[model samples]
Target chain A: MPNGLDKPETTLEKIERMDRRIVFLAIAITIILPLIWPLGLPIGVSPQVDDFHEAIESIPDGSVVLFPNDYDPASKAELYPMTVAILHHFFKEDRNLKVIGLGLFPAGPPLLQKAFEEVAVDQYGAEYGKDFVNLGYKEGREIVMASMGESIPQTFPTDFFGTSIDSLPIMQGIKNYSDIAILVNVSAGYPGTKEWVQQVVSVFDVLMVSGTTGVSAPEYYPYYNSGQLAGMLEGLKGAAEYETLIEEQGIATSGMDAQSLGHLVIILFIIAGNVLFILNKRNKNRDRGGRF
Target chain B: MWELLGIWIQVFLTLAIFSFLYRDNPFYKFAEHLFVGVATGYWVVLQIRNVLIPNLFQPLFGEFSDPWLVIPLFLGLVLFMRLSDKYSYMSRWGMAAVVGIFSGLAIFGFGGGDLIIQIRSNVMPFIDTEAVQAFTQKAGVITFLNILSNPIFIIGVICVLFYFFFSTEHTGALGVVSKIGIYLLMISFGASYGNTVMARISLFIDRAQFGIVNWIPTVIIGILMIIAFVVLAITGKVDPKKQF
Candidate 1:
């Protein structure tokens, strides 16, 4: 039998065996071009985000809004903008809401603090101790959450900076789930929205809204359907939709063009891959007796 | 100036990491190692500052030390014993306490929230009378598709569950149902994959914008990377093991 390498490489073979760098370069160009010149493509808002907005808006004035910024640096690209946008809504709204950023995971606290600095302080001139307090990362996942159900200050003795929660003006009168009006959860992975949903929301009957990473978004659908979650945001597209709803175009909004075009490129590659795979399969079958 | 400097450093790191797509090279290796070291150092400091010092040390040894805190302090020490192979067995006490507490907490949470609430919700109202009325009256522009959602949802849930029921062989009519279940699962998986792609692309867009807006530094470094890569390839210095 002739060696496969000795045979001339076909067009199908060339395309199939093409350098991975070409694929990467193609995706890179598609993404980069759109960043330079945005297409301004229209995007529709999903019902989940609508519910999320309404849930936030429905919070009574002076109610304590406890939001867990539960994302690591790896998820910052997707979840950080959502955190900033939500912070903007909380600070800008005339609700007199005491929005506290709680960090259940270690990576969550800094992102929350960064969002606060970027949106609440830099843009809206909101004070830290008065307007918001970042109850930085604690070890216990479910127990810590259950503890918060009892007492917020006890669960988180100190804020992110290690100042006592007792000292912070933001923690004044915010004792537990009963004191808190809403839970807006931003999650990347485990010990995240699900834990909060079970430990906090279900335990206390506390109304909640969640923004989760794309891969984990479907896990929350049942929660949303069950009315356990008042609203949900599924990833970057969800973030972009939220930006549109707020009418404040930021990074998420501008990135939509690239997001769309990049997806298109990926789809094209998928189609090409399927076609090449079919061709290869047919050739093998022809080489055989065309029997299964 | 510091802000700009920080952005430049981030850009350099991003480029260095992305260089791995070309081939495993010095820059990629350096960036990877640096990331591991820096992240470890940062996490260690954070744990000491935010957790250990505040939660354990201060509570036990601060001016108004709590005598009751010794129990936890001892347990924490037991956990540290895991570092030594001889004393690793002692770490189980701490591990047991952790697992027990979390399990106890999680059981309650899952029981009241997920098990009950989710099971009850699965009994979806196939057709809501109020929804039908609304659609008929055109009160909210509700479509028939809206009404069909619950039925489709219930069917999907049942089919997916059936697919997991390995006790029954997937044959004949059951095979058809199983096939449907698999199709639904694939569709769901496809959607999840699509969302993941969107997330990755979004990150790429953000970084691309950063590089474009800071073209001055990016261009200089990018060109240097290309030159170095070419020179190495010409000299046959490119590591064959690293190449795909």
Candidate 2:
């Protein structure tokens, strides 16, 4: 070749610059195939999950469990199943629960209400304001939490359905964090389990556990190690494991096989892409007399 | 019937968004615009229903007995002053109040939770009996793991802190430890990245499940979309690459 530009591109170079559409297609296939006919891979229980389960199980029947649904539709795919599974466990144990939302502006409360309606009310025949109460979404994140820490009645005067707290049978003995046996925070992002820890649990000396997104999981490990969080569920895997513990094959369990297959596809792609990149670089170096 | 229609619309929208995998087109553009519009509208409705009516409206006029409710009601209204050019500065009062309260709260909240507790927790005993007891199920393997883990945590913390300690230049032993710190930092970062990748793929799997579980509606809408997209592509009415 007369010039570098005149030389024909190597196979590695061609592969390196290949259209990204093909990669997208491969990802699409990997996720879809497993869903259509699942591999049904076993989901091993983690020590963290075992701890979480034990913490909940240790609480006597009819103990008031504080559950904060702190996520939006964007994270519904990851966090929603966990919400249902936990509610199932709570109702199964006949635990008195209060579900609240201190999450995003609009999206959090309805999901909490829906979970209550489906799992607690319909499935378990839980009476409204007797078995569970939905306190709804409050505007201030940590501020609302801090206020609740001080006084639950002062922060939320009424439940989500516009019923005064005075009318609710569930709120009779519950005044603040002290009344709650355990605080279970299933969170997606900010003003979530971390915020709850900082604002309420540490202050009140309440036992707390969290189920957070996969990305937020590693960040909370220190808190878990420190005993700030008694236990935690990390993302969908956490949810699946929890579902397994409860012996209910819920949505999280259904998605686990697909999740495993998707991860495998991504790892394979990363390896293949790196190999091609290295080959292309070596070829270029050979052409340039090993200097460039 | 209405629920079925809603599901069909959802199916169409999902396909529309997914079509971008091929290339940018009008379908993707429509879906994108529709999502933003719907989301914004939904947010507005929820705020009014959940926040304003229940918190502000009911307390003020509807069977509310508290005089203290007026204070937050006034402050919340002050937050709306940003809409006016002349009164926008008044919004600062509301903003300042929020900042002041949170800052005061953070002194104890963030400081205690993140700093004090974290630091205290890291001061682990050189020999932890609880850890030893916890690992005793498989005595040999657990002992090895406990030994491996305890030192890594302590040493990693010390070295990483040293790496960040720029008051003095890293030299000799400090330099070597700092280099070790960098390795430890890389391992932590690699773990985080691997977990994040798993999370993202979980999201993809969810969307795929949605499509598969609702195959009939999704496939019907998808085929209709493909035909419409192809006709537009052939006619040069939509540029698949640059339509968005």
Candidate 3:
């Protein structure tokens, strides 16, 4: 009974029941090493991100681009790079950027302020009142979105920093959704892209694009296909792709080698698990006289 | 100097949270509580400063610019009454107003966006020779791939919708299409799961970047944590097996 198959069977069984912590350690190492020393794997651009860049690029220069800063610190790792990359694109192209944070009220406004300061103002030398404006966070969720469709200044009379809307040079000639050329949303979760689509994109004729959390991306494919969203960026991969499109090597791109390696590790683990399962099943069948 | 301090704090917290990978301990508990407390506090302060003051307090105090603002302010205050036993009933009026307004808006939004527009978009030409011609012109090929895509899309949509039709039992031809629907659903779910795994790993990679690249201090902190863990385990204060 202690034959060639039986000897290997014990090893397979051991692997099948291998300690989970070992697996966790492998994953941790797989992610960490690549991150410490990046391989710079080329990320293939998705048609969706291609469309997202094109949507922003297609808008005439100096036209208003209204997108929300709709995520917080929890999702900063994935969404922040997208935010920075997109903002960089907007500023570089000389677009009149109007930023807002209506959803995730408490979390998004401060992050949006930080993003604008870091990307739009500090990096691009974009004049605040003239080139871009931060509408800041407002509560009311979908209701605020609906209201913005009606009137921007009425919904937010003052910017996040307390500057009156009338005083901002960028506010000139931008009265409603009609004046806005495109709505680009880099969102994390609910009351984010879907709410915007329902309240703003569908109600008015504003062209919409979104960069959402990876988990929420599949459900939104319908919206993307339907033209409710002109283009979409799904999670960190999408963000990395956008950064590539803009010719900037940011955090998202830096993390991609780690991401690729991590994904490979997971897939290998899965394959190993399946092999173990199959071997165990075959051994059980052999024990049962070729499964009756 | 301030930046270094910030980096050190981040390292400490990151290591503290990662310690849970080993076992539940005081460090993990401390980090979790601190994260929740700080995030909640930050959110509340931001809402008050950015939203409440500028939107509500300014309008109420500075001028009676829009009297309708008072109505919402009253309703919002009434929401707090639920914390008390006797006045909890008064809170229902505010709750009802909120529910009623939201429901009404949702119905309108859903019907217009989710129902009509979504349906309209799906109602494509089953066979558009024009589209085929345009693709042929653009790509310089008379391939049937463009024409074939439409029929496949239409069939897939119908079959998937049919699978969700619970009113009738799937039998015979219906059963076959329903099986196809299940396959389609599985394919979509598998693709989605792949995306989710990538997203989650990216988060971990970001944390790794923070610990290893942005702050080498965290590696030292991580080592110190491991020593503490081992010490605790040796003293019988922790059970490493329990984590497994």
- Which candidate number would show the highest lDDT if scored against the true structure? 1
lDDT by residue (tens digit), candidate 2, A150-251:
788767877787788888888887788888888999888787888889988789989999998898888899989999999889999999999999998898
Off by over 4 Å in 1: A1-6, A287-292, B83-87, B138-142, B239-242
For every prediction, compared with the true complex, DockQ reads 0.75, 0.68, 0.71
Instruction: Report lDDT per candidate.
Output: 0.85, 0.82, 0.83
Task: Pick the winner on DockQ between candidates 2 and 3.
Answer: 3
Tens-place lDDT digits, model 2, residues B93-157: 88888899988887878897889999999998666676678767557875767756767889999
Candidate 1 lDDT by residue in tens digits, B1-244: 9998987788888899899888888889999999899988988888888877877778778845667878887887899899999999999998899898888887888898899999998886888776687678774534666777788888888888889989989999888888899999999999888877877787777688779889998998888888988888889889544554
* Candidate 3 C-alpha lDDT tens digits along A1-292: 3333554447767778777888889999988888777787889898899999998888877677787878877888889888888888887765555544333445776677777889888988877777777787787888888888789888888887878888887788777899888888878887788888888887897899999988889988999989899899988889899999999889899988888888899999999899888888887778768962
Error of 2 at A239 (Å): 0.6
Query: Model 2 lDDT vs. the true structure?
Result: 0.82
- Encode model 3's per-residue lDDT on B1-244: one tens digit a residue: 9999999899898888877877789999999999989987977887787778878888887876777889888998999999999999989989999999889888888888889988888888899787788777776444566677678789888999999999889999999999999898898899999989988887787788787766568767877888998899899999988883
Interface RMSD of each: 1.3, 1.5, 1.4
Give model 1's TM-score versus the native structure. 0.95
Pairs that collide in candidate 3 are none
TM-score of each: 0.95, 0.93, 0.92
Report RMSD for candidate 3: 3.2
